[model samples]
Every structure is written in C-alpha cells, then in structure tokens.
Target: MSVVKPLPNYLVQRYRGWKATTYDNNKAWYRHLSNEGQHPRAMIISCCDSRVHVTAIFGADSGEFFIHRNIANLVPPYEPDGGRHGTSAAVEYAVTALKVAHIVVVGHSSCGGVKGCHDMCSGHAPALEEPTSFVGRWMDVLRPGYERVKDIEDEAERVRALEYEAVKTSIDNLMTFPFVKESVESDLLTLHGLWNNIAEGALEQLDPKTGSFVPV
Candidate 1:
C-alpha cells in the first residue's frame, strides 16, 4: 500500500486550491524578497511536528521568522560535528549574519519525541543502538531534566515539569554560543521560552516573575 502510487484526495484538493492563489497573491512579497535578502525579525527553534506550525502560531508571513525545526525541539550542546550544526548554524546566522533580535524555543505537549525521552527516565530504554535507533542516544540529552523533576507530586505535574524542563534546557543550550551569550547580557538579543498547548487553545510563557508557566 504505497501512498505515493496514488495521491491522497484531500492533498490533491489542497494543492489545487493553494496553487491557484499562492502565485497570484504571494507574488509581490516573493518578488520583493528576491531583490532584497531575507531579513527575518525573529529566529524560531521549534519542533518538526506537523501540528506545531511556527508560522501559523505567530500569524507570520514570508521572511518574518528564520525557522528551524528539529525532533523534540531539542538543542544539543554546541559542538562541531565536522562541518555544521544545522540548528546551531541557523542560530549563528540569525544572530551574527541576519542580526535577528529575538530567538524563541517553542515546545509542545503530547510530543512523541518528548514522551520517548520521558520513557527513558522510567528505565525502559534499551542500551543498544541498533540501525535507526538513535532514541537511546538522543534521549540522553534530556536525562538531566528527568532527574530534576522526578519528585513532583502528581503524575500530570510530573509530565508538566518535564515539558517545562525541556524548554529551559534548550534555552541553556542556546547560551553556549558566545555571540548569543553576549547578546543576552547586553539586551541585544532576547530569548523566550514558550510551550504551545494546542488542545487547550492556550500558549504559555515562562514568567521569571512567578517562576512558572503563565498564559500569554
């Protein structure tokens, strides 16, 4: 059963509709941006989940945000991987090359990648790294977050804390870059921690004043 053999009906309909208006309506912005390089206002580090749409969440249009999506919205510690760190490269370009003022790390609830990492905390994750088995190694990045919140009173609270912990961890990881650190210190660049709760129709921002997530 190959989906590639026959295109899905809904996808074909969407493609037809979007293709009709996209060129006519979006041409002006595309033409303008072609002459002038992309000057996005913010750099968004977000999840690759289809539901976690960075542009739609902010109601952003073309070139508004330099977006980078990765599994679990995780930012591995800054290290050279022979050539480039894809997410880090975007952060470097957005900070140094593009000079974006804000960089936001967006996380979400019921994320499978996050859930997989959380399950590793329960000692269910295996030690072996078989073919296509990076979950063990990848979840290692979030082991400390589980250690930090293993004592929460409620099951729901425990998950909530893990989700929140993931956000802060990425923020901590973002600061590993000297340019980002200096910008944060000088107020040249601002970092934001956001958790998008699609089910609740709510967006939560980590408020330093209350030291908790509050509705934004």
Candidate 2:
C-alpha cells in the first residue's frame, strides 16, 4: 500500500467551496493564467507563520508574486557545494529563470524560529543545540544575527531585534548568490528588507542609507 492519506473532510469541503465560489467566479482569469506562464514582478520570501498572509497582505491576485515561505524566512549564504538547498534553489529560479525584479525578505514579530534561536543561544533550548536538530542547523544562518543582539538585557526587546536582524541577514545572504549580485550591480534587481508588526498590522521597511528600519 502507498500509505497516502486523503485530506480531512473539513479541508476537502473548504476546497470544494473555494473552487465553486472563487474559482467559478474567476474562470476566465484562471483560464488565462493557465494559458500564459506566470511572470511575477516581485518574489517575496516570508516566514511560514500562518498569520502572515502574503496575498491578503498585498491584496494581490493569482500570480502577482512568487512567494516562498520558510521558518523565520532565513536565507543561507550561497554555497555551491552540490548540496541540497531548497531556499537557495527557489531564489535562483526566481531571479534567473523567472526574472523577478524585486526580491523582498519579510520577517515579522513573534517569530517562533527567532525565539528558538534566542533560546538556543541563551542556553534555554538544549535540544536545538544538538547536531541532529534540523531546526538548529537551519537557524545557524541567523546565529550571527543572534550574536549581534545577544547582549540586550531585555528579553522582549532582544527577540524583536533578532527578528529585524533575521530580515537583514537574509537580505545580505541573497546578495551572495552570483545571479543576485550581478543583477543588483547592473541595476536589474533590487533587494528589500521588511519587518511586520503582527499585533498592530504595521510594516517597517529597511533603509539601507541609514542602516535602520522605518515605518512604511
């Protein structure tokens, strides 16, 4: 037996409702999208938090953005060692193949991944420090950011700083990819760092000139 399981009844019913209501109402748009390949102008890399709705946030339609979601939305440094790199692969395809002009790394408040990094660094989460910890290994990319804010005395403030740092870290890592670097140098692509306030629904954008984030 394949051991595959079908979706739960609730989810199946929800899908059917969406297909009937939303898809049916936009049949022509959906058919047009099916016939024409997607050419999204921007690629958004965001955290896997369920509350962060990329489409709803931007009021975007079906194919306006190429969005990739992962824990803490961290992007690792480019390492062409022939290893498996899912995030890097998505970035590569979005930049080189899809030719997206804008690459946005959006981090947010109350990020579990950032909390894990803080815990691991503060000696609170020993399990995450273990060599076999997949999350810890993935979070290693943000370890440097944690180090920058580790000395902050306030716990809440420290976590928030790491969240912002995580966005900046991913933006920095994105530049390590040759395609991204070249495109940026040639003024073909631009990188953006964003932090969202989950509670207030406010967004802050990074200002490279001042090296600080300001409300958008």
Listed in order, each prediction's TM-score against the native is: 0.87, 0.97
Model 1 bad stretches (over 4 Å): 1-13, 81-84, 127-132
lDDT of 1 at 19: 68
True-structure Cα RMSD, model 1? 3.0
TM-score of 2: 0.97
lDDT of 1 by residue, 101-132 (tens): 99898989887777777767776555423345
Encode model 2's per-residue lDDT on 113-190: one tens digit a residue: 999999998999999999999999999999999999999999999999999999999999998999999999999999
Q: 195 in model 1: Cα distance from truth in Å?
A: 0.6
Candidate 2: Cα lDDT at 88: 96
RMSD (Å) of each candidate, 1 decimal: 3.0, 1.0
